[model samples]
Target: MHAHTATRPVALVTGAGRTSNIAAATARTLAAHGWDVAFTYYRPYDARMPWGAEEGAARALHAAITEYGARALGVEADLADPQAPARLMDTVADRLGPATALVLAHCESVDSGLLDTTPESFDRHFAVNTRAAWLLIREYALRLKAPHGAGRIIALTSDHTAHNLPYGASKGALDRITLAAATELAHLGVSANALNPGPVDTGWMSAEHARQLRSATPLGRLGTPQDCAHLIEFLCSARGGWVNGQLITSNGGLA
Candidate 1:
């Protein structure tokens, strides 16, 4: 492994779609903690995917990270493509040396319920959520192996996994996939873990929906991107090194 100067670390975060997006918040949080960030976004042709607004969001995040005095690269990629993860990683490495931290937060097709879910939908989710994570970890391990200072991989899961929705099931699969990788990579100085969040107020959820979720949550409030980002920032730090192979739920104390 090529050694990097110990002064500041570099991180790559995928799926940072909007400034209010959880992944974008996590990137800013990490930057505040002194890590340079490289982030990715997906642009879909569909009118529902909010692809057109991502460039503006990326610009805002770039400003936030820079305000923290860290370098930031905001890349637009289509994670639905099987080869996109490797290409995204290459872009990140080209912009900011080898990464010490990686965050897989890309998600697609949340509209697929059990009755409407198709094989194609399942495969798409698996490819973008689980398989992409696998490819990223594989590449990360190949590059940084043991003797490196506790490389970290953090995957964003969903509370729906526990509720067993079709989309949730996909996230559950992602959690399991991450755990398997963590078990194998822990001995090699890398740690992998998943973070699950409940209903978050990301402006995508309607006000009525957010209010209903807040009523259901024990904390009497809906989660915010910043709430999730705080925990992710901790996970990427030295303070969170011992937290490995676990699916941590940050749902305002909700089960």
Candidate 2:
């Protein structure tokens, strides 16, 4: 906790525990750009994924963010909890002033199709992917003291409905929910957009899958966390202020 004075700009990022993740990369990019950062993560969720959870992803991310000489804080939180989003905002404000931007990179990714969809699974995905995002965007707008157009809310999305029903459907909801936030919050200096980064290898791809993904993209490679982070940087910048209520695709022609 650096206890920064002078009202340093801050960004609150969720799912930014793993160093190999987009959340971590975005946090790093934000830090490098003179923004103090706070992040939240839930390891239990990550543990359920094929790519097992990293033991101290929060600690490692904190270290990396602070290395840029910016204050950093990481909270182990389950966004699926309705109360968690508000608590996260309060914690971030208490530690690092009000945030000017929010980047949501957390998701519940279970591989199940139409037949795989269950009450529990669908609800869990909605809890994290859709509900949490809605709350976070709302809270960010309400918490901000900045003038209209200073608030930035960006969420990561995917279109994997065929193979991953719950995950894809929930993210689809996230896209609309965040866009609605953009439309409603535009008067408050808040710009919201969804970035759909298709098929990135964040340790979630097999060698053959990675090769297939690379072959599918015209760039002949899969996306990187940093690639998404760079777009985030722009969206949070003055130049990207006009880009609002749009679902910008950052895929290297992997559609």
Candidate 3:
């Protein structure tokens, strides 16, 4: 953690364990735009994924954020634990300050559908994707200190439920919970919205799959972490306050 800059607002971005992902990109973008960043990541979850955890990713990301002259803290948190959300908020407050912006880019996705989707996997997805999101929002709302129209909350969502049942269903629930905050927290001048950035490679797509996706999209290219980060930066700014209670898609017109 670096010196607290009262002039710059603090943003807590979840799921930024790796330097290659959207959350890491968002942290860098926010720091460059005059916002201190505190991000959370669960190494155990990433280790289990097809793309194994990148060693020392959190420390590397912290250094990357500070390069832009902003304070940064990378916390290792398992959002699956029901108690983690409040603890994360307290930790951020102790280190940086109360976060004015909350961006949930974390998820528990294992790509099992229908019969293959076990009950434990379903429960885990809801616990992290849906329940943790609600808890984090609650914590943010309780501890927020931003001025009118300065509080912002953004959740990354998806509409793909066919072969990715649990993950998609949980994200669907996340969307509703996030949108509910937009109206419920209106008195605090907070705006909540869900963004669906379709088909970001992020080491998830194979060479063939990436080519196929690129060919199907009108833009003739794939979405990158920076593409999503730019929109997140916009939503956290004063200009994006009015885009409340909506689900915005930034997919480069994918077919």
Highest-scoring model, TM-score: 3
**Clash pairs, model 3 backbone:** none
Estimate every model's Cα lDDT from 0 to 1: 0.77, 0.87, 0.94
Supply the TM-score for candidate 2.
Answer: 0.95
The TM-score measured for candidate 1 stands at: 0.90
Clash count per candidate: 0, 3, 0
Tens-digit lDDT string for candidate 2 (1-255) = 212224558888898757898998999998887789998888887777777789978888888888889999998898889999999998888988888889999988888889868999999999999999999888888898765667789999998899899999999999999889887886787899999988877898889999988988999999999999999988987678889999988889984
TM-scores of all models?
0.90, 0.95, 0.97
lDDT of 2 at 158: 91
Sort every candidate by lDDT, greatest first.
3, 2, 1
Clashing residue pairs, backbone N/CA/C < 3 A, model 2: 148-188, 148-189, 149-189
For residues 1-255, write the lDDT of model 1, one tens digit per residue.
113345567888988877777888899888888888999876562235643465467788889999988999988887767687777777777777767888888886456566667888778777777777788778776666324546888998885643235567767788888888788876677778998877778777777877788788888988998998888888877778789889988888754
| Candidate 3, residue 31: how far the Cα is off, in Å | 0.3
Kindly report the root-mean-square deviation of model 3 from the true structure over all alpha carbons.
2.4
Better of 2 and 3 by lDDT: 3
